[model samples]
Target chain A: MKIFELGKAKSPWILHYNTGSCNGCDIELLAVLTPRYDVERFGMLNKGNPKQADILLITGPVTKRCRERLLNLYLQVPEPKVVVAVGTCSCGGGVFRHMYNVENGVERVIPVDVYVPGCAARPQQIIDGVVKALQILREKGRALEVPPHLKKIVRGREGGIDRESLLEDLRRR
Target chain B: MKKIKVNQEICTTIPMGSQHVALPEPVKLVFDTENEVVKRVSFDVSYVHRGIEKSLTTMYDFKKAPYVVGRICGICAIAHSIACTVALERSIGIDGEVPDRVRAVRMIGLELDRLQSHFLINGHLAEVCGYENIFMHLWRCREFILDTADMLFGNRVQYDVVCVGGVNRDIDEKTGTRISEALEEIEESIGFMEEVFTRDKTLVKRLEGLGVVSKDKAFEYGLVGPSARASGVKTDCRIEDDWGMYRDFGLEIITMTEGDALARCLVRVLECFESVRMIREALDSTSPGEEIQLRVRDNPKKDAVCRNEAPRGELFYYIRGTGKKIPGRVKIRTPTFANIPILPHVMIGVRYNDVPPLLMSFDPCLSCTGR
Candidate 1:
């Protein structure tokens, strides 16, 4: 019934979160926005506030210190948000996989829509991941009557997956 | 004089790492504090220490050493590889004169690194200042420099351009012309950034004299790069060693006398200007010639130490080859190590509010420090 949702889905702003891996993926993620690759052509904007973002491009393996903050950030992004785990570290804890401190991959921390793999994940791969995420977002938005349990998971009070509870948590304790 | 005391009974000591909020890498910094103002800060840094030096010795052959060492510092991998390869070449006495074109490409990679690293640290410093907008702006500007690097080299961080003898890729006329145009825009952007940095009264107020390590003390602590230069020391490994194409194509090192966070920031800004000059000179003077790379010797036996002025400070790489598949030993003394030793001394009396900026002033990449 939403007539205007498709236009917004076409141009999804991104919020990049770095957990703990080497900064290689961060640099390559940046390269996607640069003139050469120019992922902005696909209507990607790097937004600072997670609340305003449509896609989350996570570039590192989640760490103990950053896990809570990362989860809080992911929850803040409104419904139909997609998570794109870019880089080997984020997809699966790359070289630092063995480290005791690394909490696991980005998916373990938050649900991931697209997984882009590379030691540092090339700019092209990152762009491809974003495109895939946008497609997933559109598909999810068009879905009809979700079952009751799925509704609770997506928009719920007890499960705490809803936006308002997440916002409340974002405020410093 | 007023003094604060720590109550060991009721106080909970936060064992903040092998990892902390400011660091991506694991390095333990034990804090004994009543609250946020750390009464005492002590740390242990062997967490991520993979015995990289030993690994370097056993894992890589001589030709493969540069790329392996490039993984040393993710941010400054280009400098690590360049310094190591240049040293290895010198040790084996392979006088593969770097063509002006290769020098230009190398300079582009190096300067772009300097631009990105400086902006990154400065943005992080702004975060300490609680100026998030400026932090975003600085980081956004850094993207342009990243794009420039990606265009020149295939990868953004690990360019993998520098081979044993010379640079791997050549700057074709179209790419070169495009890069020249990009540099013009980058310079203008930098000029705009300078205006913003200098005019931001709040930033200056917070950063000014916060972490003032005077010239004499800076020299005493053996700080290098802009950290040393900001203290009025004329010592730079680049000028002193005259390695790489620097001797042939001269460079002017930027320096200052304040030795504070502001002065260090100023040193980086001035150095960007210097880097721009060097890049311009290298580009203008470049002449197309023979192959950019020279054939590596089949098997070589030698031990060499090379030092370069990485964006952080002086990066020293020591390599010993046993004429085997792997290097005998590879030792790295990164800038953070040299700068970190001076931290406890500088932090002795500054207010608790000042510690973060002081840490940022040194541009401590804890990953590089621990690695």
Candidate 2:
């Protein structure tokens, strides 16, 4: 693996966006950053800039106004990123599911990799979800290391390079 | 459109949220500043509006209103549920008939909610002011309060403990003793925090005179909770409203005359002690394993309004029933909604750097405001 991928896997910076949560999961996610949970011990830092974030932690069901902002933030994050939906509201809208203003859940707006389920997810559960997100982040990092079109060329056939297959794959690409 | 002239050469407009690191919820503030001092401010708090009031009247019936309203704001979930349940009970004509044990349990839940919410905002205030160590320490102590709530009510943020007419879960002997033990530890930590907040020169200097709200302005803007009390307004819904047994529990209202950021922080810090005392008194007043919930067969027929003191301020709930399963209307006025109007007033004259801390001092819960 490249040194950049190794460093990215070791430390994942988080960008937290609240679509329209009750402030329960948001605080618990903050609690995970504070002394008791101390997620910083694992080299994870909460970043305010979406451009610098490696993982997007979202809370609340997507509100009509926030839906656009959520998508904008999601698009701004650099690739090899993960999105973790915290709390039941973001998971499937919880109690606010059918509310007129809400879009049901975060998944309706963004692709979520990990869904932490709780009315207001506890700090422990949030930490678990983040840890799961880290694994996905590492897998995504590995996936991005080698381009899909170059796979056949990099891992050639039995004795020599498969130039024909490589050319076909290049043409297809 | 209404237009105003700006001296653009000497002033710059800065927009601070909707999504900010200092704010847990989304709220936007546009500040017009000249020479680092704010000349004016405008705000937008509609980012988190979930139409909870409409849902209460349309989506859910009166019986499920308490749980639905609890989602208005998670930090003050108990306050919303209590106020909603009390209003529902009154509309159903069972206002003062709830058992003493039930009220005690409800008080415990509400006070614990206050303790956690106060800790959260105070720690957040410190963090925004660049005092990260104090923020961590305060939040570290806050875990005890969350654990106690989890032990008593099975969930950390949304307790779902209060229901219509009574409480859903009963506080037994074991949980009561456990709560007492946790409160003792919490009190020790709070004492340490009190010393730090009162004597720490840096924190005091950073917060002392920033965002000063005069007594008249607090009344004029209709500030509630700690923000109003900090300005010597002497208003607390816990005393004015008869929903809880706070009077019997010897609840003392903490007030300060300074009305600055520091005073607001101090008011919340001191109120934590009162919450602790009330929680202890509440546990002592109630016996173990008595009646918890009371059943009611009739739907609400009349309109009733209930008010409760949330950690931030007064939380008001109005419900009108038509003798049907669902209420005809439900209106909720949260504490943050009352407290937010004063922001443009307070932020106008403060330094740009102090904006985040000053805003944090109000403990703005935009979810509550927009919902």
Candidate 3:
């Protein structure tokens, strides 16, 4: 509904972090930014800084050393953000699962909203996952606008703000 | 000439990685700089270590080792697989028994892999130099190579074509014709890129005379791949090790004496033309309806070493078999591992701002190093 929220859905800047990937999914993600499969046509730009990113695209099975940094990056992104885990390793640790140094998948460290599955996930699959992430970003934007408990009082109003309902809503909380 | 006095008190220590915009993988570098010029540098490449060598000896058997090693570095998956297969075959005492057709098909796979990997690093190097237009154009042309690879192997990044005894897929006449057509398009684009890389003053200005590794220094540091070749080291596993059909194809090693970032870029661009020619020659030499794969019955009982010329450099694999399905020990020495040690040497006198391009010139693939 708000201008910033609309902008957030329209152009979702991506922050790509490779926990311990083989560079397969990472290159494919880069290919998505290039001419042939350019996601820039949809206003998607890959940003290096986590603070400016709307979505975090992560590849590779999380390694022991990268787990701390991954968490740090996940916390740095402001709220109303989405996490998309690309490649089979990030989804469920495809071949690197149960390895000594790896923590299996990105889900072990952070919450993931979309899982793009492939050994080195193809560019088309990555684009589809990103599109799905945009919808999730829009939904998150809507959810962040109003708290769940205050929704009843905000919607029950006829013409003016009801003091009794507001008071009751506060008491219930 | 006056030598400036060194001052440790004025030098600043700056850490540039683990995660950065200029780097595709996770590699941390600590630079000791005095005023803007670097005095010394050190790097940490353990971030991507997945214990693949340990897993190969303990968890996976010889039959499945090729597929497992293919995941070591996705950029050169075929190279890894071929090296692993060669090691396994040698350990089983069947190294010289493979048919010519299988070798030809495998060579095609490796050359195509080299073509795309060179394009990737060149495009990435241009991007780090702030030349996004050249980067975009180069990658746009790279799609044809990937398409040819996809047509041949049925996968883009992880082409699991190599096996222990032979390769998995054979190129039919129809696919071979299509690949030839694709190579023609790729060659035309490569010509355009070669002109830009050689003549473009701005791109050359950023890379030339930076990170000069003298010929003696290259041999002293034991640099492998294009980084060493750029210094005129004349070290290529394709020639040094007879794992593939490079000898039969009369492979000409590309070398440059400049030993700077520009020379490294030029070596890769020039090598692309050789890759195209090799692929064409391989396609012409091999025919359809030939046997692509051979059956393997013996388990490895001896130690064998296989060296492969990957897109980055020489990829070495040492496998010790204990007359069982699982190997006794599997050790991998990737080219990046050999090339990374030379970074501190190269980055010592360079400016702080030129570190990214200098680092990119080596084409550091930490996944291969750490694995």
- Best candidate, lDDT: 3
* Candidate 2 local distance difference test against the native: 0.88
Ranking by TM-score: 3, 2, 1
Order the numbered candidates by lDDT, best leading.
3, 2, 1
Q: Where does the lowest 10-residue lDDT sum fall in candidate 1 chain B?
A: B16-25
lDDT against the true structure, per candidate, is 0.73, 0.88, 0.90
Per-residue lDDT of model 3, residues A1-173, tens digit only: 47999788888899999998999999999999999999999899989899999999999999999999999999999989999999999998888999999998999889999999988899999999999999999988887786667666777785345888888877887
Off by over 4 Å in 3: A147-169, B1-8
What are the candidates' individual DockQ scores?
Answer: 0.13, 0.77, 0.80
- Give the runs in model 2 whose Cα sits over 4 Å from its true position: A147-173, B1-9
Candidates, ranked, DockQ: 3, 2, 1
List native contact recovery per candidate, as a fraction of 1.
Answer: 0.10, 0.90, 0.88
- What are the runs in model 1 whose C-alpha is more than 4 Å off? A1-20, A27-85, A89-113, A122-173, B1-28, B34-37, B44-51, B95-101
lDDT per residue for candidate 1 within B189-295, as digits (tens), equals: 68866776778899888888877888889878898888889889888777777564666667877888888888888888778777777777777777555778877
Q: Which of 1 and 3 is the better model by DockQ?
A: 3
Weakest 10 consecutive residues, lDDT, candidate 1 chain A? A144-153
What would the per-residue lDDT of candidate 2 be over residues A1-173, giving only the tens digit for each residue? 47888788778899999989998888889989988889988889998999999999999999999999899999999999999999999999999998899999998888899999988888889889988999999888887676765755766664345778767887886
DockQ of 3: 0.80
Estimate, for each residue in B245-307, the C-alpha lDDT of model 3 and write its tens digit.
Answer: 788889899999999999999999999999999988888886874666777899999999999
TM-score for all models, in order of appearance: 0.76, 0.94, 0.95
